[model samples]
Target: MNRNPHGEIEEIEEEYNYVDAPAWTVDKVAAPQDQRSLFFTQSFPLIAVCWLILLVIMGLRIHFTSESNAKLTAENQQLEILMHLNSTLLAAHENLGRYCNNLTVQFDLLTQNCTVLESKIKDLTAVNQQLTADVQNLTTRSLQLETQRNNLTKQIQNMETNWNKLNVSRAQWSIDAYCPRENNARLCKACQEGWRLNQSTCYVVHDAVSTSGHKTWEEAREVCRRESSDFVIVHNQEEQYALNYYSWFSTLTTGYWIGLRAEGWRWKWIDGSDLTVSHWTPQLPPAADGQCVMSVQNVGWRSVSCAEKKRWICKKKALYV
Candidate 1:
C-alpha cells in the first residue's frame, strides 16, 4: 500500500493462478498473516511518538545554526572597524614624530648660536680691560711729565732773573772799577792790576817787605775794608788750597790773617756764619776772647792774639766782562 500526492491510500493487486493446496500450508500462511496484523496494530502509536521526537530535534538544530551565523557576522564587522581605527592612529603617531625631530633641530641651532655669542662677549670684555689699563698708565705718565715741566719752567725763570742782575752788576763794575786804571785801559780782565784771579774771585796777598807793612788782625781787616774787600775767607777746601799755594812763606812760623775770629767763645766767619769746617793745626791752642785764626803754608790754621802782626790776604768778587 502507498499514499498518493492527493492524500488517498491505494493498493496494487497481483494476478495469481488459483491452485489447490494442502491444509497444513494453508494454516501456516494464515497464522503468519494474523500475527503480522497484530504486530502493526500494537506498534503504530509508538512509531508516531518517535517521529514527533525526531521533528522537534531537527527544528531546534536549525534555530541554533541561524543564531550562530548572525553572531559570526557581527564579530566580523567589529573587527573591520578596529583595523580602520588602528590605521588612523598610526598615521597621527608618524606626524608627531616628524614634528618632534624638527623641533630638536631648531633647539640645537639656537644653542650653538648662544655659545658663539658668549665667546664674543668674553673677548670684548678682555679687550676693554686691556684698554682701561693702558689709559691709566698713560694718565700717570702725563701727570709726571706735567710736574717736570712745571719745575723746569720755574728754574728757567730764576735763571733769567739772575742773569739780569748779573748784567746790571757787570755794567756798574766796569764803570767804577775797570775804567779808572790807566795801565788796564781798553783791557778789561777778570781782576784788577794788583789782584790775582782764582775761578770767580780776585785775591790779593799783602806781604810785609818791612816791619811797617805788617799789621794786626784788626788792622788787616780794616785795610781790606778800605779796598772794598774783606779778609780772605776760606769757605771750601779748594779756596784753602789755593790760598796755601799763593801765600809766600819766609819761615815756618809765618802765617796769614784770615777772616775767622772768636766771638763769645765760638768761632765765626766775617760773613756771620758759625764755623762748621776747620783746618786747624795739630798744635793749635784753645781759643779765647780776642783770639783770631791764621793760615800757614803747608800747615793748618792757628789761634793767635788779635793784636799780633802778620801778613794778610784779601778776597773780592771778580769783575765780569
Candidate 2:
C-alpha cells in the first residue's frame, strides 16, 4: 500500500489478468481478509440505498395501476346504465308512436261516423216535416167530411118532415074532394062527373073550342074552387108529360093555366111551396111577380101574364077503395 498526494491509501493490483489464469495464483495474490472486510463495509451502505429506491418505485406503479382499474370499472357501469335507459326510452317512444297512430285512426272513423249521422238527421227531419203536412191535410179533410155529414143529416130530417106533412095534406084533400056533402056516411067517389082519373088524382082539362071558352088565371082557379078542386099541380116529369098531353095548343099564344107562378126570380106553387122542378120553353118569359106558368101541348111550360085568357086544368085527389 502507498499513500497518494490526496492522502488516500491505494492498493497495487497483481498482474495475472489472463482469461484463463490459474486460480491458485490468483488467490495467492488476493488482498488480505481484513482489507476485503473493510472494503465491503464501505460498499454495503450504497447497495442498501439503491434497493430502497427500487422498492419505492415499484410501490408507486402498483398504486397507479389499481386507481386506473377502479376508474375503468366505474366508466363501464355508467355505460351499461346509459345503454339500458336508451333501450327503455326507445321502447317507450315506439309504444307512443303506435298509440298515436291508433288514436288517429279512431279519430278519422269517428269523424266519418259523425258525417253519416248528420245526413241521417237531415233525412229524418225531412220525413218529419212531410208527416206533419200529411197530418194537417188529413185533419182538414176529416173536418170537411164531418160538416158534410151534418148537413146531409139535417136535409134528411127536413125531407122526412115534409113527407109527413104532405101525407096528411093528401088525406085531408081526398076526403074533401071525393066525399059528397049530402052523404053523412061519407061515401067517397073516385072522381066527379067530367073529371078524368089519372094515378091518385082527378083531372079536368077544359078545352078552349073557341076563344070564348078561355078564361083568366084567377077566373079558372075560381071555377075549380067551386068544384072542390084547384088548378093542376105537376109534381114530377111524368106528371108534367101528362099535363102536356092534356093541354091543347092552337097557336103560339094559346096555352093552359097551371098552379105555378113566379113570386120573384123563382117560381112557386099556389100552396106557397118552392118549385122543385121546372119544364120551360127555350124562350123563357121575363121574371115578374104577376107572371103565371102555362102548359102547351108537346111543348114545355111558359110564363105569361096572370090576367091572360087561357084554358085551364083542374085537379083533386081521387078516393081510394
Candidate 3:
C-alpha cells in the first residue's frame, strides 16, 4: 500500500510482507520468544522498583555480615592479648624466684661474717683480762721490793752508829799513851827494866809460877801485897813476859788473879785506878757461882771463888823515872 505523505488516514506500511493470503487476525496474536526483555522494556518502571528493592536487601545482608565479622575479630584479638599476658606473668615469676635465692645466699654470708666478728671480740676480751692481771702482779711486786729497801736502810743506819761509838773509844785510849812504848812486836823490854817508862813510874814484875795450887781470893791478894812492899802491878806486855819468863804463873788453871774484882759489875784497883786492862774469858763472872771476877792465866780465864787459896800474881810500880 502507498501512503500519502501527509494525508489523513493513509495506509501504514507493513514490516512483514505477508504474501499469498496471510492477513492479520484477531485470534492469532504474535508473542516474543524471550518475554524477560519484553517485559523489561514494557514494565521499565516496575523493574526499576524491583531492582531498588533487591539492592536494599543485599546491602542489609552485607551490613549484617560485616558487623558479625568485626565482633569475632575483636574477640579473637582479646584472647590473643590474654595469652601474651599469661606468658609475661610466667617469666616474671621465674625471675622473682631467682632473686629470692640470691638474697638467701647473701644473708648466709652475712651471718657467717657476724659470727667471726663475735669470736674475735671474745679473744680480745681474754687478752685484756690477762693484761690487767699482769699489771696487778707488777704492782704487788713493786710494793714488796720497796718494803725491803726500807728495812735495809734502817740496818745500815744502826751499823754506822755502832762504828762511830767504837771510833770514839779508840781516840780516848790513844791519848792515854803519854810516853809511847817502843815497838817490839807488842813487847816493851826497856820499860819493864825501869829504863823507859810512862808518867813517873817503873815496872817491877814478880816471877811466873807454872805450878798449880788452889788458893782463896783473899789469901792470894794478901800474898801479892806481902811479896812486894810497894805492891806488884802490871805495866806493859814486857812486864807480863818477865813474870812468865820467871814461871810465876800456874798452868794447872787457865786464870790467876792480880787485883781485879767485880764490885757490883765494876772492877777498880784499891788506889781508885780503873782496871781497864782485861785478859779474861767471855762471861767470866758466873751468874750463880757467887763469883764476881775472872782471871786469864797461861791458857784461858775462868771464874774463881773468893775463898780459894792459890798462887797469886802482883806487880810493883816503882816511883822513879
Best by TM-score: 1
Model 1 regions lying over 4 Å from their true place: 1-185
TM-score: which is higher, 1 or 2?
1
In candidate 1, what are the lDDT values of residues 1-321, reduced to their tens digit?
222433221111111111344555665446545754675686667777777777777787777777777777777777777877778788878888898898899889989989999999899899899889989988998998899899889988988998899789867776756545566666567787788999999999998777689999999999999878998877788888887876777344568899999998888899998887788888645658899988888787888889989889999999885
Q: Can you write out model 3's per-residue Cα lDDT over 34-91, one digit (the tens) per residue?
A: 4435745766777677788888888988898788789888878887898888888888
The C-alpha TM-scores of every prediction are 0.44, 0.41, 0.30
Model 2 agreement with the true structure over 68-167: per-residue lDDT tens digits: 7887888888889889989999999999999999999999999999999999999999999999999999999999989999999999999899989978
Considering TM-score, which of the candidate structures 1 and 3 is the better prediction for this target? 1
RMSD (CA, Å), each prediction: 16.5, 14.2, 22.5
Question: At residue 196, what lDDT does model 2 achieve?
Answer: 89
